[model samples]
Target: MASKKRIGLYFGTFNPIHIGHLTIANYMVEFSDLDEVWMVVTPHNPHKKKSTLLDDHHRLAMVRIALEDYPKLKASNIEFGLEQPNYTVNTLILLEEKHPDFDFCLIMGEDNLKSFHKWKNYEVILERYSLYVYPRVSQGTIETQFNNHPHIHKVNAPIMELSSTFIRKSIQEGKNIRPMLPETVWKYIDEMNFYK
Candidate 1:
């Protein structure tokens, strides 16, 4: 019998999938024990305001484009069909039940680790899945606090200060956003006039 592949679930709105997103995903696969990383595109994040979201399909498409060159990375729209205001715990539960063969881990930035306790059913998450946390700028305090969690693993990747919000703002302001995202993703965003 063959062993099941280890999968990491990287959930995000990915409002516009940028190079930073791809870089971290690639880093996880290249440097960690996980065999593949799925960029789980959430339809809507419970913690974020809806007004800030781009269309889920568009965001998912951007993720696909951004990861096109990396065969180990995939874009998942699993939450698109689920109910709105998606929670990580619920997604984890569903994926676990649906695919029991693969070991699952949650990939996140240290910034998210700070307010993790406020997330719905966070304790359950901590108990069930391992967390791969990457360091981020301005993440000093939160990273220190989560260092004690049994399931938590720290990852070091080049810190790209770019963010979706900054990309969106650049687009809206008619500034060039080509440098912030992957080439394919930038082309797709330009063709679709996304964030404009």
Candidate 2:
């Protein structure tokens, strides 16, 4: 029998999908055992305000365009159709139901892992899925329980300090932050006058 495909689900709002996002996704798929990395464009994040987010389709489009050249990378709008205020655990359950042949894993930053214990059903998630964590510059220390956990793998990928909020603010302030984004994505954002 053929082995199940290992897919890494990198969840994000992807307000505009900058180079940092692409770099991490590319690195995960290429350097790790993951067969593909899906840039899961979240439509609504329960913690963030909705007013600041662009339309769901717009964000998904940007992710799609940014990943055009990377065959191992893919854009997924899986959360777009899900109910609002969705949790990661719920999404994982749904994904498993929909694609049983694919073994899904979560790709997150060290900052997020620090608060993983607070997530709903986090223990259940750890039991079923593996987590691939990348380094990030953020406050707070990781929980002692997660230290050397068998399911958690910390990758030594480049630390990307860029943020979508910074990109948006730069555009609104009339700064030329073109190099921070993929060329096609920059063009799309410029043409649409987004975040202006």
Candidate 3:
């Protein structure tokens, strides 16, 4: 039988899809063994406050617009079909069940590794799936708490300091946000009068 495709799942709110997000996804596809990278838009992050988050639909739309040109990158709304407060573990379970042909791997940032234990059923995720962790600006190194397990691989990527919070704040403050977001997404945000 033919081997199944390897898919890396990058979970985030994607309040607005930015260059940092694309750069990481592109790096994973070009440098890593991952066959494709799926940007999974989580409507609700359990650990984060939802008050400032853009609507789930809006976030999904922007992600789609930003990632449209990349063949190996995709925008997924899988979390939307599932239950609320989309936990990473639950999304993994659902994806595995629905798409048995695609071998799923988890992709996260070094910063996320700091509080990974706080995630729901994190142990199961670490044990059952392979993790590709990228470096984040000012995050230092991986915490000593985590071992250099074979399942967890460190991807050699540049540290990126951009963040959705900063982008949103700049938009609200009437500052130029063109540099932080994809042109299509920036246009969409402006046309829709979002984040104002």
RMSD (Cα, Å) for all candidates, in order, is 2.3, 1.3, 2.1
**TM-scores, in order shown?**
0.90, 0.97, 0.92
**Predicted structure with the largest lDDT when compared to the true one:** 2
Instruction: For residues 77-137, write the lDDT of model 1, one tens digit per residue.
Output: 8787777666788888888888989889999887888878889998888888899988887
Q: What is the lDDT of residue 36 in candidate 1?
A: 99
> Best by TM-score, which number?
2
- Cα lDDT tens digits, model 3, 3-120, are 9899999988898889999999999989999999999988765557767788889999999989889999999998887766567888889999999999999999988887787889
Clashes in each model (backbone N, CA, C under 3 Å)?
0, 0, 0
Question: Residue 154, candidate 2: how far off, in angstroms?
Answer: 0.7
Our tally of clashes for model 3 stands at 0
